[model samples]
Target: MATGQDTLWEKFIQPLFGFLIDREALKELSDSIDWETESDRLKNPDLIYPEYYKSQNFHGIKGGYLNSSAAVTYDPITKHALPPNENWNREAVIKAVTGNPLKIIDLGCGTGSTTIMLKQAFPNAEVVGLDLSPQMLVMAEYKTQLERLNVQWLHGLAEATSFDDSEFDLVTASLLFHETPTAISQAVLKEGFRLLKPGGQVIILDGHQKTLRNTTWLTDIFEEPYIEEYAKGSVDAWLGKAGFTQVLTEDVWWTNQLSTGVKSISNL
Candidate 1:
């Protein structure tokens, strides 16, 4: 599972993206970038966020969401990290959520990978993507604009957002929970519940916490600060406690799982 790209991700790219960043990022992939401007461009001044969102580097990436270098490398790194299966793994998430969705929101959507796929799958839907990382959102914005996909980008926290209550028809979070502490993960679930309308469903795709089927290699190569708590915990129970019902969880790939829960009418 170790791609031996550790140097490329951690050390070598560090000096490149951190200090010697090139002003123009689109022309060359290897150039270091000023992520602060990228972040400010996508950031919302009024949205409130918890401390945990700012403190940890969940993926061993420097500056976490604030690094422009990390943002550009994220998509390619993940694709190579999971290889051929990575493409379909995201597709499984979209497929798991059934019915036609009119309004959709993707949480922790990094570099617009899942966000783009979501728009492609449901072209007519008004899709919005939110991420803590403005650098990632900048990359997402660049991507969506290039593809001409009308996906909306936002800078906000998933656990707490400025959106109205029960505003979305379907809410989805991909590869988010494992990066966060268990407490924050639960808060995110509660937030998802609060955002969904009565009977609206929420979809979550993340690392397989329950099954130790084939994760040894993943741990060897990657650095995930909160993945252990996520794998051992019960997202199903969290959703239940958040007042969601009709919950279902399924394994999508060796490293991923997709879970869906309908917002309970009783909770309404």
Candidate 2:
């Protein structure tokens, strides 16, 4: 029953279109909407508590767009040729943590795509996905179940996580920083510092503020109002103040950026 269009969609069009739509639509929507007014509406209640999953809509268009867009770029074969930008940074995190990880936590693990990849990369590590959206977490759970993967899904927030101090071997985030407010962003960094064990790493994979200059027209067309703010934000400074050391920042293709730092073992 499958047709050429289906194959093409599966192979190329879907991923490309999803990617374009995600970047473009998110930027436009963020710019047009008053985030302060919509913050409550956007917050998924199921995320605030685990018992409310029935109210979530896992297949909504926006959720679909996010899941598909993220998954497409996560596929190593497709991602390398297309260069989802964070490929190297992702690899770096995996290599650094996988060596002796007993457990790993992925904050803002949307649809668990990145979490799934991390699980595949290090099957020995017990991987957990934490997201504030129950809809996204549901999709992630479904996908992981279908794939027969063993991953723990938790409803949580990055700004104020439920995990105890030094609970994880590594704390990683992908494409999450730019979406939050400045204060919340700082809280996320501090939370990462608090949750990670001594000598553990906090690897961030997101858009590079500096690289925004190179894609001015694209950014404008994409309708990203926060793009400028994110470009001007001081993520590195916040991380440094949070007490992380050996900070490394790099720009990747597809406009993604990497920031890696080590938590001081002595502080723990």
Candidate 3:
């Protein structure tokens, strides 16, 4: 079933998001950034700043604007289609954490796609979407209004979420890990663990750098400046050290993977 989903994602969704949407947005966003100069600095021995670890506003504006445009252009059909199969994984995460309904938090939820999807899947559960970009939050809010989904949108950082501890039944992130620094990534994981209720689950859908195997050439070709390093990062180890149990990591696509961990019920 997962394999069939992956095939559909690659054959259909990937092209739609990557070529139809992401490529143009990424190109414009990259051009707006000083990638060449930053690339040079990254090659320097003393330059410790990671090349891709930037929190600039242009990324927010460009991404938010493009996503908003995409949202508006796609209208009802496109708006409904944004979640992709990752939403299916989110449903599985909800089932894994609690047999019935569960409150879910979507960290780094861009444009509120995952957040709305969660609401659709579990209408009874409270859903919160947190992001660092205010512009993105606006776009998310717009989408939520269009769908009439009752979701709370918050402008917050993943590394230092404002929510109280043990507040959520499940915490989820999709396509977010690879864009953050190692330190920030660890901090986000810790925050996720802190936010979950006892027996709550943390489900992350992101790239699986370790699973590239035979597609090294294509992987490298398609991967951006930070892809290689992000792929090599030890997210599973970070989650384990953060006091999560039942840590599970699995390959999903040419680059995508799903990693999850559970907060023990005793700790809740």
Q: Using lDDT as the measure, which candidate wins?
A: 1
Q: Which tens-of-lDDT digit does each residue in 221-253 have in candidate 3? A: 333334445666877898898889888887664
Worst 10-residue stretch by lDDT in candidate 2? 52-61
> What local lDDT score does residue 123 receive in model 1, on the 0 to 100 scale?
97
State the displacement of the C-alpha of residue 254, model 3, in Å, after optimal TM-score superposition.
3.4
Q: Regarding TM-score, does 1 or 2 come out ahead?
A: 1
User: What are the per-model C-alpha RMSD values against the true structure?
Assistant: 4.8, 10.6, 10.1
Q: Could you give candidate 2's per-residue lDDT for residues 1-268 as a string of tens digits?
A: 1232334345564575566555565455345534333334444455544222233222122332223333333332234332444356466556545347678899988767678878998788889998776445655776787899999887677777777888888888876776555666778889989988888888887776777656554334333334555666877887898899988777665567778888987665
Candidate 1 clashing pairs, residues 3+ apart or interchain = 21-32, 22-32, 209-231
User: What would the TM-scores of all predictions be?
Assistant: 0.85, 0.68, 0.67
**Which has the better lDDT: candidate 1, or candidate 2?**
1
**Going through the candidates in order, what is the number of backbone clashes in each?**
3, 0, 0
lDDT comparison, 1 vs 3, better candidate: 1
The clash number for model 3 is: 0
**lDDT-based ranking, best first?**
1, 2, 3
